[model samples]
Target: MYKSPLALMVSLSTLAQYAAAAGFIDDSQLTLSLRNNHFTTDNRESRGKIGNAAYTGQNKEWGQAFVLSYASGYTLGVVGFGIDALGQLGVRLDGGGKAGKAGVSRTPGQLFPLESDNSAVDDYAKLGLTGKARFAKSELRVGTLQPKLPVLLSNDGRLLPQTYEGYQLTSKDIKNLTLVGGLIEHAVGRSSTNDTGLAVNGGTRQSNKFTYAGGDWAVTPALTAQYYYGKLEDYYVQHFVGLTHVLPIANDQSLKTDLRYFRTSADGANDTAAGRAEGYAGAGYASTTGKIDSRVWSAAFTYTLGSHTLMVGQQQLSGGSGFYQVAQNSLPNEGAGPGSYYLLTDRQVSSFIRAGERTRFAQYSYDFAGLGVPGLSASMIYLKGDEIRTANGPDQHEWERDIALDYVVQGGPLKGVTFSVRQASLRSGAVSDLDQTRLLVNYKLRLL
Candidate 1:
């Protein structure tokens, strides 16, 4: 069933009225957050060789966002019910007339709305509503959602976070275990003000159904395991398994290991040749077009001592096909936007998830608190990927190096203010070469 905005508003209004009259105000909460963002990218894809929009060249933009949210407590009853509302406004600080062209912000109207000629509009705003019902240790939510799971993770690389329209159920009735199931229909991109149907990468056909089920189990005090299954109707089906363990070596030293695996296969339209011709195919590097068959696995290890941490990891992808993930850009109605994957290689500049690819990564992170400088920290990362399978041939490779710094006000008039900076350099034989930087400031306030 489809509903107009007015109909949805009326329904929300009725729910709010009922909840208020039932004396649920005692547990309600409201908050407002402000964020300022400055992003720039310089892509060196060689003149006339820029096949992907992400490598279009020097693109830069500045924007600010305000997020206002309210959550109402459940009503007094055997089965409690509640409501949540979220509203956001984004405004452009500086951008116009082809100053840059890299991420969504470079598209003029992406961060803000667009004018008649595709120039950036001054500002744009969107509102969302969610209703919740709970019984015992189980809760059901229907409406806007931001989910962080092995199957699907929301993107927040830009000024605002991506959101999905769906119905989800979460239960923690069993000790040390969590169960989650959901059905997603539509998604609002991190940059766009509109909603688009879901589809796999490179699939122009849109499907409103995305089903998923998953669970997380804490096997022991230092070990955890996870399993999940997800399917995008007519696109692909995927299964994931994950394990994490930590071993304490000494009072101040420990080793943590993280492992992940994924298996994917074509489904419905994507499983047939004719269906692929009709735009139901997978994206990224692959030997065959539109065929979704792949296995990917990765393992990471970290050693921590005092304020210093060191990590290394590697990922491998089978040559049958590239990894698959739901993205709105692949939908026929959206702007062919870029989406992210769940992998260690999904970094600031690129994702090393190509067919037959193998990636190795390392990182060093330090906390300033050990040096008497609280609320400050920094990290550096380097990743290399090789043995990619492409239509032309194989043996392609890419690498990226990144540095990040973050600081927060510990105590003062602006106690909770934060500032962060990130810089990255990427070199790729198959994709494109580029340098990028991002600066962000954030503050939050209690409203009620």
Candidate 2:
């Protein structure tokens, strides 16, 4: 709300007279980033759910984005105060159609907002602000928030990033442990300029309130454990637990293991069959009408040697329901809702979290620096999921493979600039077979 120069200056003036004026001014940061993205996708199958070509076929789009970020240092005092700001602008470059064209009424692609005649907007902009206060080892932030906890994962897969409107409190008051809690009211999708209420996939209704609490404990220098709980008002209640451990196999070799589990069930409106028929429901195969009831678990292990890293994982979903996460698809012409879930299987294409699905995945990445080529890297990921539950069908299966290459300017004027190329292919019996590719160029500037 403090958009005017006068309001911002007033807020800044209050910091000087506080306990530590130097801390407030000395620790401030301002940065600018330019990101160029080109996306292309090919759908090997589809006649459109609405029985039209508008929602099927190939999709290609390009865009340029400018992101400005600023973080102010807290005033040195018993209760420190600070502020954060994010400003973004997106310019359409080319293309109109989106990759996935589902639902009844299909709009234009997901890259940019559509005009009155279903044309892409030339440009769009957005702003975010956060006010914060710190006491001892705890900090409370109110306003725009981006949470990266187990319960909530902010998505940044598109030209811009997904953000939330709410307040969050984080504390390190306890030794060897970090505590976090937040209350979010709304979410902005990756390709959306407007903030919408929260809901599950296929949910026709929306809920504005989402609450979460969690903590991470460092059991030892090589081991950590985590637990988190989240609830969407009148939708579902979810719980998560995780463990991570690392062991040194040699001076230059190490192995790491990660385990995660989630339990979710219906609540409030979704608690009754009548409420589900009224529109409060989840996506995929649901044993109890439209209710949310599922349990998911995954375990992964990684081995690192010099510049080579290999990781393998498996995940399973049970209870006649798909994985539960905050997704807002109740509206028409929306992208894949909020963002990516915190799962090893969350990749460039399918997420592999279908109902009763069992997924096994693997990845291998290498750093070119080991071969005397600094700032270069490559990675390959593959995932296969089977035993997908369906209401009318016997069963289903799907698989995806992704390959990526990246390089960064090591020196000269273009130093710190990055170039990346990513390609993905998916084969499935659920939606459609597809191939996707993305190219990105990025540069960052430090203004302060």
Top candidate by TM-score:
1
Locate the minimum summed-lDDT window of 10 residues in model 2: 46-55
lDDT of 1 by residue, 1-448 (tens): 1124344444545655665677877887767788999887776664212254444556667899877777889887789998898777777898744543334345553344456677765666677889899898999999999889989899878877778999999999999999999999998888777788888778888889999999999999999999999999988999999999999999989999999999999899988899988988888755667789999999999999999999999999994888888888666544435566778889998788778889999999999999999999999999999888777744788889999999999998989999999999988877668788899999989866
Reference-based TM-score of each model: 0.91, 0.90
Off by over 4 Å in 1: 1-22, 47-57, 98-110, 113-116, 336-339
What is the clash tally of candidate 2?
0
Over 1-448, each residue of candidate 2 has an lDDT whose tens digit, in order, gives: 2334344444433433341344665778777889999877776663313222333456777899887777788886799899887777788887653334453112245567677666677777777788999999999999888899887899888787888999999999999999999999988777767888888887877789999999999999999999999999989999999999999999989999999999999989989888888788887788876789999999999999999999999999999688878877565555535567888888998899889999999999999999999999999999999998887857888899999999999999899999999999998877777788999999999876
Q: Which regions of candidate 2 are displaced past 4 Å? A: 1-23, 46-55, 97-108, 332-336
- The lDDT, on a scale of 0 to 1, for candidate 1 is 0.82
The per-prediction CA RMSD against the true structure, in angstroms, equals 3.8, 4.5
lDDT for each candidate structure = 0.82, 0.83
Q: Which pairs, if any, clash in model 1?
A: 59-100, 59-101
